[model samples]
Target: MEQMQIDPENLISIDFENGPYSKTIRTFRPDVYTEDGTYYALLGPDKATGILGSGAGPDEALLDWDKQLAVFISQKHSPDDPVAEFVFDTLGTSKKDVG
Candidate 1:
């Protein structure tokens, strides 16, 4: 897998189904805005291949690098914003098809 740092503004579009999927996962740190905005960070692989969902923080989702993609399908949480909803939806479908 490849890895690179990107400018947040330059990350306007993310096509996870493409070759960049492996390099498209990372932890997100959001900035405060009058209205909520969605941020996408790439998650890298460590050991496992499952998705992890946690509501332990305020309106935030974290996907572990080592977890299986299937683990994310079982998570239940309302996306705080549209971008997040899109990410979850795409991830869910991808995981299902791959499984």
Candidate 2:
């Protein structure tokens, strides 16, 4: 298994054609790996509140991660929450340390 430690700030949005319409998906930088043939996409850090997704393949696991993260985003919370801050401000494409 291989793992990559990313800055998360470099996350990019992908444009894909869905049938007749074009869609833009802000891709999460999922750490993809395989274990015993099952694939997994681990998002964020490895802690009690970390996000992890598992599936038969890498793409499936990434999809699962996106879905779970979407739900988490839809929930209400305070701006001071670390996880939420990281996900929406740090990990997201928003430029934080700008001039």
Candidate 3:
């Protein structure tokens, strides 16, 4: 297996529109946005698989993202994959105040 490198210092923050957010998915809260009447989960950078999941409502969209995140982790994608890294980074940062 090819080794993947980790560049923690070089890691960058992902941008999401200041829209609705929810803590129902995983431990972290992913920003939710709507486009063309469909809600989407803003997972990471726009250029690379920006919107990971989409659905009719925020709850469904978040559910899809949670399932996608689990699949991504189970697949064991190379750490060099930005999409994977972005998903990890997004999930790692949780909203401390959320209950």
Off by over 4 Å in 3: 1-26, 47-51, 86-99
Using TM-score, give the best candidate's number. Answer: 2
Order of models, best lDDT first: 2, 3, 1
- How many clashing residue pairs appear in each of the predictions shown? 13, 0, 0
The lDDT per prediction is: 0.33, 0.54, 0.52
| Residue pairs with backbone overlap in model 2 | none
Clashing pairs in 3: none
lDDT of 3 by residue, 8-94 (tens): 443223232353434435444555666667776655555144436667877677778767666655565554666566555555732
Best by lDDT: 2
Which model is ahead, 1 or 2, in terms of lDDT?
2
lDDT of 1 by residue, 26-45 (tens): 32222211113443333322
The TM-score that candidate 1 achieves is: 0.23
TM-score against truth, every candidate:
0.23, 0.55, 0.53
Per-residue lDDT tens digits for candidate 2, residues 1-99, read 123454454332223233221121234465666666776666655523555667786667667766777676776645555556666664453423211
